[model samples]
Target: MFRILNNSDTFITIGREYVLEKYDKKREEWLHIPLKANIGFQADGMIIDSGSETSFFASFDTFNYNFPKGDYRIIKVLSSEGDGILLYDDFKIDK
Candidate 1:
């Protein structure tokens, strides 16, 4: 789950855009992990009013893919055409 806060003075637009990346300890860099298939479509636009917030549930299934255990993050794309604000949070896979 993730919460998006709109603290600005004007309305903000958001979409269901994101990419998954894994941290390479050896290289000290993040590498993009391409999805086996398109999980979903991008939203035309979802608006959040000023000083408001919205929460959404997100899940990444690694059952089919052989993803190694390590640190990872979801690069949340907040605009269209892969250009705009980006928000991310880190997570770890112990299993």
Candidate 2:
């Protein structure tokens, strides 16, 4: 599971085992995000970027979920014809 610990970068915390990642993009040090053996799904080419402010999972065929029932606002994005992005205000990053 992944959660947002800040307003800018989304922290990717591993589940419950010995998973490790590079602390720095250009370093040899490794940091661990716990491992959940039975994640039930696979990310063939998972891309988790800290520069993004929101979480997204795409390319999945279908999802078994009910739509959100709450007050929400229209979100707008500007991008090329092939990409989609999100926009929000009151930006802050906190853990």
Candidate 3:
């Protein structure tokens, strides 16, 4: 799950992408899931309005088939125009 808060008074159009990561025992490293999907607001490719916060829910099934239950991190890539920002770095999912 993710939340976007628009503090500005005007509407904000943003593009978003999500990346999932988990530890790989064999390689002793954290591996990123290959699923590159968009995080939409209200509707697919929709814009968020002023003083509104929106939450996006992502299911494990959306990333892969039969995803293992463990500690995982969700990376949110948010962009407006050509500038991109990475957020929710400390957020983790333990299932």
Candidate 4:
């Protein structure tokens, strides 16, 4: 689960486009991981007024795969009047 806070002065439009990536120490890059197959339906985008916030739930089937314990991040794209901004949040999983 995650929350998106629209602090800008104008309304922001957020889409369902998101990616899950894992950091590879050797390659020094974030590799994309396919995990959306486990999630259910999603809407195209949502408009949030200024000073408003919205939350989204990301459900994954953790039991099906053995994920490595390391740093991961969720990248999201937000736009306002066709201008887009990339946002991300990093997290760690310890088994």
Candidate 5:
């Protein structure tokens, strides 16, 4: 899947692309979706991806979170920089 989306700004004209790789040691193929843009908020580290899933934003060095005492699971996802990122979900933030 090689889809291109133009993300141009007043000083630049950039775009995003998605690449797929196959015949590796893993499954049939892999999806590489790169969201190249200069808009909104940016995570210093990395994050997961979804076809149309909503992702939250938070800075551990700035925000305070009261995580419940419960079991959780971590899932890995691909980022725009072609890197694997593990994100923790099912958690709540304090008001």
Candidate 6:
């Protein structure tokens, strides 16, 4: 789970992806999936500030369909500019 609060006056757009780790009796591997809507595949990818500090919530429930019970990590990539800094990398989902 991620709660982003844009304290700045302007809106920000951030690109996101999930680095999921799936484990079985054999081995474990990672999978990357882009964060987008299931129906449209459109990237709205922007956060709008509503005068006051705007709060945005993001989660990766989509992986439930493809991945079985395991461990996972979500990484938020700031792809707008400069080195693509990783914003968040602590999110772990387990089942």
Q: Best-fitting candidate, measured by lDDT?
A: 4
lDDT by residue for model 3 over 72-92, one digit each (tens)? 667776555546657654434
Inter-residue clash pairs, candidate 2: 14-33, 15-34, 16-35, 17-35
lDDT by candidate, in order shown: 0.75, 0.30, 0.63, 0.81, 0.29, 0.47
Per-residue lDDT, model 6, residue 47, is 45
**TM-scores for every predicted model:** 0.77, 0.18, 0.58, 0.83, 0.20, 0.42
What TM-score quantifies how close candidate 6 is to the native fold? 0.42
lDDT (10s digit) by residue, model 4, range 40-62 = 44778899899999998755452
Candidate 5, residues 1-95: lDDT per residue as tens digits?
Answer: 11222232212111121121222224544323222354233334422233323333333322132333333222233345443333323332234
Model 6 lDDT on a 0 to 1 scale: 0.47
Instruction: Write model 1 residue lDDT over 1-95, tens digit each, in one string.
Output: 88989877776778766677889999999988766574564567687788998876665662235668999887776643344778898989899
Model 3 whole-model lDDT (C-alpha atoms):
0.63
Candidate 2's C-alpha runs over 4 A off are 1-28, 43-55, 58-93
Q: Tell me the deviation in Å of residue 91 in model 4.
A: 0.5
lDDT ranking, best first: 4, 1, 3, 6, 2, 5
Model 2 lDDT tens row, 1-95:
22222233443322111122223335544333333454443423223344543344321123232223222122223222335444322211132
Worst 10 residues of 3 by lDDT: 35-44
